[model samples]
Target: MAIIYPLQPRLSSTSTKIVIGLIWALAFSLAFPQCYYSVTQHYPPRTICMVNWPDDYGGKHHLTYQIAMIVLIYLLPLLVMLITYSLIGQTLWGSEIPGEASDHYQNQIQAKRKVVKMMIVVVMTFALCWLPYHIYFILGSFNKEIYMQTYIQQVYLAIFWLAMSSTMYNPIIYCCLNQRFRSGFRHAFSWFPFIKVSEEDKMELQHTQTFRMTRSYRTENTKSTVVRHNSTQHDDHTTVKLMKS
Candidate 1:
């Protein structure tokens, strides 16, 4: 959605939602077999030093499938995210809002830049976390001797956990990088005995709300001014026609 923001859309919201759902469903479906095998068959037995199950799970054909799944799930998404963010960064830096309120325009652009930065961090984190884990599997699948040593097995365990831990880091990143999330976290945890919402945070939240209200008021005022100008023109035209008649 950020990719096409502030522009007229060629597709409806329902179509966009359906397209997103279908893409995610397909990606997950492609990924289900590896998860199913790990859960139902085995959990990285020391014998195989990987998540192979049923004794023939890592057969030549299955290796091919796993390779494809890696491409679809990990690599492809990273590539697309990088491209999308590059475009967004360019657009944010290149475009300017048309108004006399240059300060407000710059503030809006800065806010968007912050959002893009957060998203880039997220995308890079995902790729960094999974790349090593997937490499371990790819090596194990093709070169059976790669997993023989105890040290290598330990390394594999570390990489596997690193990938699993990726899901745990995003909220922390958002909390640290995004003010809205910080304010939200404080509010959500305000009831806790140890958590304190600081005075600065309260002031920041109030300032944000005020800014939004001001923008809304300006928009409404502009619309009303246009309407009044049109009405005045119509009344003048009617008077002129009455005098001529």
Candidate 2:
């Protein structure tokens, strides 16, 4: 007989990534005040600001650009982590249709493929979005002329903030795109007071139950076989005694 495997609950890698990403975010936020102070107070007005005034400007505006850069550098990667995690969970845990085992299995496989494709797209997008800023900054370190342009500074700051906002948007995506994560998060607080058994624990319990059932069945079968053998031997002995009499 073909044994049907029971549906197993999928584990969330998303939770782990979310925790790490949040830690990074908090650290960045905590460091921001000191960074702002150093830029506004300690650095020379020209060093912190756009150097070119009028046509090319640098000063406080430049400082804002730097702050935006710091935030974006931290935020975009965290966002990617979150989005990837959610996608992974969704691909693993989505419901299967009943009465169509093959179709359901095929759907799951397709979902996994789609997740891989999405991951590649996300990685490329991150690279494209952040690479320019990193290159510009590296070049700017050598050439002061880059910092002298007010319009360039504005454009850089805009891109930086746009990238940084990706981090904040992950939570929104989690709520919107992945139903499993959304439901899990929604009910998480409800289980706060109680000790919850993990999915592993539940699986262990199921295996234990199955083992006990198999053991009981085997024992019963063995007892029945022994009883039948004894009865047959007794009947044979009686027939031989009657024939001899």
Candidate 3:
């Protein structure tokens, strides 16, 4: 998604959303299997040591701690992203109503709002899916025995996978579902090295440049005129003084 953002300006909100969703999905897919394996392989009988840790505790304790750490690391960033996106979405979508401002500004605001909201939803979905795993881990960390219980472990695994599945689902729901995003993504991928810049946009940019140049020129000209006028007055005064002498 980050890669997609810089590659094309015309990329649709849907495409961005899909890209983001897919990223999360891929991460979850890859991580969830590992998580499952870790739980199943290490938690039972509890005699495996894939990574080395301090020998303060037995293998089971080490595995439990490692799993807890993994959950915390993944969960924190996801939570932060979700919170940030939610705030951004609210700012974008809820800032101003249609009739509250002029048509031009209002439309601009609304469009921005829509984009923000879509992004927020995309991020929010990822956060929602991942949150359960983190919560479970946090609780489990304090009470390893409770976490090791068959029912508790089963419930955590179920929720964990469900959250991970969200990563794949996000791309489909946000990107594939929206027509604009689909078109944007297609267009972006179609051209190899070429960029698509609209004629109207070009003209507008040119006009803005011309206006700034004109203003600068006028300002300089006005300053020159004042300087010339001052010189002329000084010359006239000198001439009158010389005639009087």
Candidate 2 residues 1-245, lDDT tens each? 01121233334699878989998997788656546545232365454532332222344444555456646664666576667556664544564434656875785566455545555555555555666666665566456687678698787887677666544554554545443444555456446766465665555456557867996687678779999999999999999999999
- Candidate 1 lDDT over 26-51, as tens digits, reads 97888677777664334465333234
Instruction: Please identify model 3 stretches exceeding 4 Å from their true place.
Output: 1-72, 79-109, 176-179, 182-245
**Cα lDDT, model 3, residue 229:** 100
Best-fitting candidate, measured by TM-score? 1
Tens-digit lDDT track of model 3 for 107-205 = 567656667756767776777787776667556545557755769757977997877787786656555444445444445565756645455545545
Answer with 2 or 3, whichever has the higher lDDT. Answer: 3
Candidate 1 positional error at 191, Å: 1.6
TM-score of each: 0.65, 0.38, 0.40
Clashes of each: 0, 8, 2
Q: How accurate is candidate 1 locally (lDDT)?
A: 0.80
TM-score ranking from best to worst? 1, 3, 2
Enumerate residue pairs that collide in model 1.
none
